[model samples]
Target: MRFTDLISYQALLEPSKPAIVAGGKIVTFGMLEHAVRSLSGRIHALGLQPGSLVGLSIEVPSRHVALSLALARCGLVSVPYASAATLSQLPPLALGLSDGGLVVGSAAINLVVTDEWFAPSEQPVPDVAIADDADCRVFMSSGTTGTPKPIFQSFGGMDAQAQVVANHHLLAGRVSRILCAMPLKSAWGYRSTIAALANGIAVYFAAGTADIPMTLAAYGCEYLICSVYQLQELVRLQSETMIPLPSLAAVCTGGSLVPAELVRSAQSLLCSRIILIYGSSEVGHSALEVAGMHPWQDGATGFVTPWTEMEAIAEDGRVLPRGETGELRVRSFAQARFGGQPAPDGELPWFYPGDRGSISPDGRLTISGRTVDILNIGGTKLSSERIEHALKRHPMVIDAGVMGVADRQGLTEVRAAVTVRGAVAEAELRSFVATSFPVAAPQMIKIVAAIPRGDTGKILREELRALLN
Candidate 1:
């Protein structure tokens, strides 16, 4: 079923139930359905085909959410761009992803949806049939390299993945209110929002990271979905004043490497269950760990979900035994595809998630690092995540990023950049690293106000290297 249908079902069951809260405005399920249907009727008047691709560039979360549901109801593939992207970046991104159609706020590129389109008329919400194989949504990859690649999710895949997320998180009926602090364009935000709405849960969109605690307190939200960096900032803020969010039961964090220290601190300050999720756009949640229920290790990402299959493979493409570190490959029941490629030949096809990790004999997964972020220094391979984890152990360091840069002699040398809470001597940090990891210690350490990161909180290795140069 389409995502809009989920909203419609909720509206049918509880029309007066709060559906979305954004920009200090609350929209009930009934109001949401009416707006979606009205907007969808306008879209259908544009003569766009069922399977046509459309780009969404709306800035307001409420409007963005409404238009997204309208597109789904119209059976059109929606490619939502990050509202914060520059004007110059939007054209290329829309052109590359959308099929000659773009919707920016209330305006349309190839078609117009004016006041007349939404005027009183009996247009019966245009009966459009969507095939299961048709592309339902296209999510842009968070890679820092060339043009962002589009990851397509079929309608069936979207529903299945949403179900898996809802079931795994115990979101259905159990969660009444949730707060989303991530960008709407992100896969995590899109999928999580759908799961919440499908489960008839009310969602509140925080204005920014600073507003999250207030939003949660104001809405009395029971759950929060945020990135690791946001969680860290919240923990830091909690240390100052305990933001009253007594209803908050769980805080789900992912989209980057989550420090064990951050999890422990958040649990103490927030007084909520902290869940660490490990997954990517290509594959829905593969593993997760709950703070109090699961044993929190330095790099452990929890155990693989029952609906997913995971394996670690060596460079030679041979599957490694448990306890051996290698690249992780996962296959889920959701059957996610990279772009348009089908799963490889097997009873269940495996999709390599580009992360290096290992599974223990008891089925716990430990994420070692990213395959692309591995650093080669003096012929010794080192995981950047390992080095960053070590740096964060320092009392003064709040954040750290490590990368490999070339030296004057043309040899690769490990370089580290950090964001510290207070003044920290370079020699002191170097001595701390040298004592713990002498062989893989960074050759140079630079203290900056903040480390560079992409939208998903992954460290931009190239950007970090540029800072060193």
Candidate 2:
């Protein structure tokens, strides 16, 4: 069943239960259901047919969620974007849903909704039959490389992902509310919010980074969903104030590597465990590292989940054995290819997440770095993640990004850019990594104000290279 089906079930069982809490307002399951139906009718009245594509750029999280469900309920595909400016160029009839009305190329359709589309509507929504394999959503990639790629997802795939999320042990019992700090436009945020609502959990969307603490305390939220950077910032904030969050049980983080030092700082200061998940927009979740339960390793992501398949492969496409580092591939029911292309020969395609790493005999996964980010130093490949982690081990270094630059002889050499907490000599930092690489130590080190990062905390290699240049 789809997430909307689950919501309908929850509405019947517990109509009064709060499904969404935002800006001090609560929308119960019953209210949510009515709003979805009313909004569906409102959209259908616009002459938009079932299976039409719609873009959502609403700034309000609650409105975004409601409109998304409305789209799904009436068999329309929704493409949600983080930037409101993106809404200006959508295809005809594929209008962007804003807080005010439908936006089409700087013009508003004025499909106005009374009472914010919460009132019950006698207007009939299209009774379109939805097939499991029908296209439902288009998720945009993080775009660290360049332009974001559109990944199409089917209803069955979404259902599988939602079920996987709802049944995960970490979200079980008494974990009724969560503060989703990530924007709903992100795959993580939208999927998690829908999954929570389907399973009768309340979702609180933080207005901004500054609103996290107040919302968590006010709602007594037991769980927090955020990125690795946000967790670090929160830990720093808690360290300064020494305030306690008695309700917080854990922080689920992903989108980037969680440093061992940062994890320790969080434990000591925040009184909460950090759960580092490894996944992509194409694949839901591959592995997870839970603080306090697993030993800290430099690039350890964690063990593979039961629902997913993980393996390493060589350049020739042969699957590598455990302990042999190579490109990483993942297989899951929720996975989609880069461009909606089906695998050749009708074979089940394994999604190459562009990560270079290996799995141990016990099924643990360690991500070394992005496949594209690998440094070709004199024909010997090196993982930038490994180099960056080594540089970060220095006391003064706060963060680091490594790249390969060509010299006068056209030979590639290692180079690094770092953000430090205090003064550090370039030679001193170079010496720090000499012991680890000896042969391919960074020939040049540059101090930078900050490293460029995407929304989810992935280092923007292209941007970092530009900064270093």
Candidate 3:
């Protein structure tokens, strides 16, 4: 499959199915297909070769979905860039991709002299050809290490990943709608779009955070995919509004190491099972929760396919015995970026996804913390996840994030920020946390409506750091 066939196949079978609802606009599968066919014709007229790489920088809309599916139908490789990129970044991206493309919605830089703009399009970028082995899209890292590395994923691998997300999160489901912020351009958005389209469901997008529920009600959405943090926020809102939301089925929050508290709260609020989906643009299956009525059963090591195996290995480079904590690693179903290195055949490609976890005696896996999320608090080594897990046992604390901020003398104190159950006293919550874990008791606990989460439900550590300062 060339990846574009996701919605195309469904359009033939269930053309009347709703495909997208943005604002008040609703696009049926039949209508979206027509738009794609027409836009593809316009795309070909633009002289961009079929299978060529093109970029899109636009807000989420029916047209965004139409153009992407059209490109897939037309066999063009697409990379949807974040709006955060600077004018200085475009020309280099253009030169490196070597695909003559233009900014879809920008006027200032497009009008100014630039080698990147072959011929500008105020409309979406057109379709071009992409090879089976060719790079389909490039994912830039968060620039945590100064500048982010642009990671390229293959079209074939991404197709398999779509299957993973669908099966793992129940997108191979019967639902009326799917929702996201279009936060990540890769599987989070692309595969999500494909999964829903493949299953003949509608996808809805809220213009901003304030309108999430309004967007759902407006679109008649029933299924949602968000970062863990987004789910917590939703729960906080639901607790307040006391309004019945669009009937939800399943929720999958990716793009970071999602917290169980986020899952627990959303499960209660949405009245649906919350499955933690672990994946990245490089490879989709690090692991995932099993589907079915018992999806969140404590020990399921994500729905595994015949293509890969999951491992928990210690710092000593040995796969840990069951019931021990170590770094989580994976072998891919397809060739992918393994620990920042290229895969070689028959080698069983592996990469540490920065999660710290333990394998159970029953052969199930449990994630404990991030491999990099370790610190020495007064010479006692502690993983932030341990304190968090213990702290969340309290009913009042809905979600919690712990960080060991070390000062000048190398003394590190653990700081905990909590998304509480509606409104709870701050001092009492701190005392509750202090009484939970003796190893790294929280010196402080701040309650908010919800914790700050990035695209994926992982607590934004930097944002929490700012809260204390």
The lDDT, on a scale of 0 to 1, for candidate 3 is 0.61
lDDT of 2 by residue, 1-469 (tens): 6788898789889999988898888988888888888888877777766667777657666677888888888888887754434433344335556555544343234333346566777789667788887777777777777556677677888888888766552532369898888778777887888888888888987776567877888888888888876776677567667666788887788776667787888778755567778888888878886766766666788789998988899999899999999989887877754453256775557787888888999888888778887888767787877788788778788778888877889888788999998988998888889888876678889899888877666677778888776
Where does the lowest 10-residue lDDT sum fall in candidate 3? 107-116
Best by the lDDT measure: 2
lDDT (10s digit) by residue, model 3, range 228-278 = 456656777776775667566666665444455556666667656666566
lDDT-best of 1 and 2? 2
Lowest lDDT block of 10, candidate 1? 91-100
User: What residue pairs clash in candidate 1, if any at all?
Assistant: none
lDDT at position 169, candidate 3:
47
Worst-scoring 10-residue span by lDDT in model 2: 104-113
Best first by TM-score, ranked: 1, 2, 3
After aligning candidate 3 to the native by TM-score, how far in Å is the CA of 337 from where it should be? Answer: 4.3
Task: State how far residue 147 of model 3 sits from its true place (Å).
Answer: 5.4
Local accuracy of candidate 1 as per-residue lDDT tens digits, 158-237: 88887877875582137799888877788888888888888798888987778888898988898888888788878877
